[model samples]
Target chain A: MGFAIDKIRADFPILLRQVHNKPLIYFDNAATSQKPQQVIDALVHYYTYQNANIHRGVHALSQEATDAYERARDLVKTFFNARLREEIIFTAGTTHSINLVAHGFRSWLQPKDEIIVGQAEHHSNIVPWQMACALTGAVLKVLPIDENGQLQLETLKSLLGPQTKLVVVNHVSNALGTINPIETIIEMAHGHGVQVLVDGAQASSHISVDVQALDVDYYITSAHKMCGPTGVGMLYGKKELLEALPPYQGGGEMIKEVYFEGTTYAGLPHKFEAGTPNIAGGIGFGAAIEYLNTIGLEEIAAYEHELLMHATQGLKQIEGLKIYGDITHKTAVVSFNIGQLHPYDVGTLLDRMGIAVRTGQHCTQPVMDFYGIPGTVRASFAFYNTKEEIDIMIKGVQRAVNMLQ
Target chain B: MIIEAQQEIIEEFALFDDWMDKYEHLIGLGKTLPLIDPQFKTDQYIIKGCQSKVWLRAEQQDGRVYFWADSDAIITKGIVSVLIRAFSGLSAQDIVNAPTDFIKEIGLNDHLSPTRANGLVSMIKQMKLYATAFAAQNNA
Candidate 1:
């Protein structure tokens, strides 16, 4: 089925606003997407009716909260096609999710145990692993990407040795919108007896995911990336692997028993969740998943793919615009630098025209270092984004170049 | 149509005119930052979400409030200069009553990335909280 832009745009309220006397053209989807009415309404419904601490009380309000929270978990499991809801853990978004894995999985690590990550990985994915390796006497091995921002598999194969314990890769590059060949990555990692974790923060919104079919041991996603609440996210693990790992933080609801001498931890997902959770966020996330499911992932992906093509063609026509991450089989993220213009300056100028595109490194500094540039102005798209918006973005970029040049 | 925060901030550019020269003098003033000892950059004093290495030291001289900020980066030093000019030597009520209009006044917010602005807000809030504590201590 093809994408239906008109129908999709109708669902997002913010797409209709104006900026600087011009219609608002929101192209910064990779940073965070606009929440649909269903998700917003879900948050409102949650706070208005089911507002209580979850998983710890027998009161009616607690029961409602707990049920809603678990239902969100079930929705996530279904969204990712995981085998069990217990395998999914709630988190404060992708950054926190990755940090929890780093902290919790530290016990299993050893000196010189190689942890492979990609050069294009976000700071969240890179820094935590760097800290984990630094703390645990492990070595961080990087799989380099070529000029186009796609990983060189032959180089990656050379880097993957017997000592490689874990391979963490982004399923989609947020800066470049490069849809990585994760299936191949998982297969290769498994061949070397290495566990793999995929940062699906970008991919969860654009692609359909099936954890069972991919055979990935761990996958992390942020709900805000997929039109859900800002503070809520999920970490999917194989049940056996999660059950064996240690708890990330010590607090209420994450433990089954506590005492001065000894304490026992809660099962699987709960072990990672410490203190009071974002109860409203979880329900909102579930609503976001339901909303996406209704539209169909295939429909969204196909429409966005077309938008990417249109955007690429439009962006290509602009002079002095050097596009980053030109992958043929990528999603809808287009990052580019206008010659002689600082990204911050360009972003400011674009704001004057009501064009919202992300500037700076997009939080991928290593990638910026590789390119030997400060940063790029990134215009990422969603299913609701129209070709007309890209035209506006292109005109804005041209104006920026002319004004600054 | 939304007026870019940049326009609002830029409108009050005169407040920070020659801010660079003033910033240099501020750093020179920072050299006179009171002695609390040299070993205060421990993990306890570290503030999260800063791009530059910053160390904040708070002290009181009789009735007035004084702050000492040292950063490894030049722009960060400039930022500290702006903060010092805005809040230093004020009475506790003055410190508490001072509006964040200074950011817009100097166009500092216009030049800053959103994250950097947030970090700046955190720093200002922390300084204000410190002032509040000093006020409480004196009252007691």
Candidate 2:
């Protein structure tokens, strides 16, 4: 079925907001998506009516909150199609999730053991692995990308060997919007008996993720990027693998028994979920997943692909404007620069026109260094975004270029 | 006279109701900013904590400090130009003592983004550091 974009746009209250006396044309979905009224209402519902801590609470409100919280975990597990609900661990976000995994792997990884990360990784994915390598004495390797901003799979094949302990790569490049060949990468890594962690921070919103089909050892994504609240995310791991890894943090929920002499940790997901979780955030994240399912990921992907095509065509018409990344297999993210004008200047001008676009290296400084540019103006789209909005943005960029030049 | 200069800037910003017009004015100011020497664009003169690369140089002549600055981003360059216009060709002590309330009076600080605000703060800090350095040299 064709996606009903206008009706979907109405679901978000922030779309009605005006910036600088003009209608807000938000194109920064890669950074964070606008929450639907349903998701916001879920948060309010949790706080107002079902406000209580989970797990240990004996009260009805506590049980209700616990039920909702655990149900949210089920939603995430189902969303990613994991084998067991116990495999899904709620986290502070993608960064926290990756760091948690890295922390767990620190003791397991040996000196001279290799961990491969892509050149186009967000700092979240790169820095944690770097720290993990530093702690374990493991050597860090790079998976190089070609001129088109796609990962060089041939090089990745060569990089994978007996020494390679893990492979970490983003499912979609947040900076470039390139959809990586994760399925293939996973297959290759598995063949080498290596673990693979797919950073799905940018992919969850635009595509459907099946952890079972891909069989990735670890999959990390943030709720905020997928129309959910901030400070909440999930990490999907194989149940055996998660059970094998030690507890990431020492806390109340993560403990099976507490003893001053020695401590035994909780099993599976609980062992990793340390401390008081973002209870409200998890409930809201569940609501967000429900919201996305209503529209369907396949439908959203198709609609966004249409938007990408239209935007690419419209933006290419502007002279001296250069679009980065391989457009063939990418999300609806257009990262570009016009002539000699700085991205910040163009972004500033766009803001005046009531358009919100990201203008910076986007936490992928290594990618910027590869391109030999400081940054590009990134305008990423979602299912709710319209063709008319793209048209307005193209015109706005043209006007900005004219004014700046 | 310095306060009067700030007032003039406030009045100048007041002429534009629309942010677009104000930005256009800023761009015009940026275009007219006196170019810094290529040698001065080195890492030593560059201001840290800015999203944009900003190079600032201070030259003391006749016991007065003249500030020259440049930025890769036009809006940032424009912002730097405004600061230079307010502080340049003044005595080191005078530059140090000059009120930065004009940034608020003109609503530039409020209107600027968080990153740009940080940049603005860093720019002001760099200028003040230069003023203090020059003041110490003269006193010594």
Candidate 1 wrongly placed segments (more than 4 Å): B1-140
Q: Considering summed lDDT, which 10 consecutive residues are worst modelled in model 2 chain A? A: A1-10
Candidate lDDT scores, in order, read 0.82, 0.91
Tens digits of per-residue lDDT for model 1, A307-326: 89998888888887889888
lDDT of 2 by residue, A73-154 (tens): 9999899999999999999999999999999999889999999999999999999999998888999999998887999999
Candidate 2 accuracy as lDDT: 0.91
Please report the candidate that would top TM-score against the real structure: 2
* lDDT digits (tens) for residues B1-140 of candidate 2: 67777788889989998777888888899987877998889999999987789999999999889888789988888889998888888899888888898887676865444456228888888899999999989989
Model 1 chain B lowest lDDT segment of ten: B1-10
Question: How much native contact recovery, as a fraction, does model 2 achieve?
Answer: 0.83
Candidate 2 similarity to native, TM-score: 0.98
